[model samples]
Target: MQNTDAKVIDVALKYGYQSVDAFSVAFKRMHGIPPAEAKKQGLKLTFYCRLHFALKIEGVDRMDYTIIEREPFTVVGIRRTTPYGGGTWAIVKSNGNNVTAEKFFGRFYDLGLCFGFGQDGSNDYMCAVEYDGETIEGFDSFTYPAAKWMKFEAKGSVTENVLGSVWQRINNEFLPQSKYKKSDLPTIEKYVSWDEAADICNVEIWIPAILK
Candidate 1:
């Protein structure tokens, strides 16, 4: 599903509805806002440069900004096909591989975005701060180091939009908010990617960082 359609669904469910029109009615009643209002809130997805596209920095307002001690771990993952509003493991499975969970021990970042929290209940779980960039066939294996993590959260239907939204937000708002005084580290997103048949994705993003 596209971002627009996903927003419509979220609004409808929030207001309680068995139908789209009924949900729209309830939406306007509760918030005195129309369902279209959600869609009208067009978020910026492009930044100053194409290479640096923009995304909405979510969950930032809720960050604790307090440091927490973390232990390191290893994660075995694969860089499979991830569509904008699709499933990651599902696509890989369709290609005839089972979703294998690895003993991923690494730094965990709290962005409030997990796989099970989204439409696809399977993708949500932990967010990795750092992982070995080694690309292996069928799957990738890597280890993350203990570091300060900046977590960003976002809500969207299509999987791709969620990633893009957070990326844009970081580049436009969060980075500048800190006066570019902080160090930039690995940027990772926990998202779902399904086959062409599936749509809708929820994402959580974690970028390594430290106070300037």
Candidate 2:
């Protein structure tokens, strides 16, 4: 584990925080897993942090890991079979649509959460299914370009409250104040443990971002 990513709980507790739930969400969003699970999996965490902006406060904990580069891969999965909205309901429904794809390939990617592209703030967009490099019926493979990405780990319910709040913070607070700019790469959520999301879930959010 690199010293760059430190545990976040320490800071939260220092600031008189009592709710592990909230602290866990903030920690995972920054590190990619709960403090307990991160220790269990021995996953290193690393990312650039700006302290002047309070992007992180003192006593704020982080994971210890190096920021390593990763190559891009192609994923293929079924398109939406129904008129799915672009909200939590739509994303979850389209991802979990187990038609013939699951049986043929054991299990396509776990019911990962997804968001569709839109012109503005509209839900009338096309949702997608993710493939873990495995082929399935009615699924076409699409490749996302490889680029330096800003990744964060998070856990908890895929509820609109949690995710929506995070998105709002990133778009409204974080990006605008930081020297980095948001890229066009689509947002994604990869859940390593769906069942234990509340307590300990492995959530990785990747966004293509470049420094100004």
Best candidate, TM-score-wise? 2
What is the overall TM-score of model 1 with all chains considered together? Answer: 0.40
Task: Estimate, for each residue in 1-212, the C-alpha lDDT of model 1 and write its tens digit.
Answer: 11335667665666576677888776566445565653332221211222432495343332212222245645554343233233554444465433232323232221222223334433433322234455445444445567755555555556466557656667666566552233433345654332334555555555556655
TM-score of every model versus the real structure: 0.40, 0.52
* Alpha-carbon local distance difference test for all models: 0.45, 0.51
lDDT by residue (tens digit), candidate 2, 66-126: 2224467665543343343445434435566544445655663543324454455444222
Among these predicted structures, which one has the highest lDDT?
A: 2
Candidate 2: 10-residue stretch with minimal lDDT: 59-68
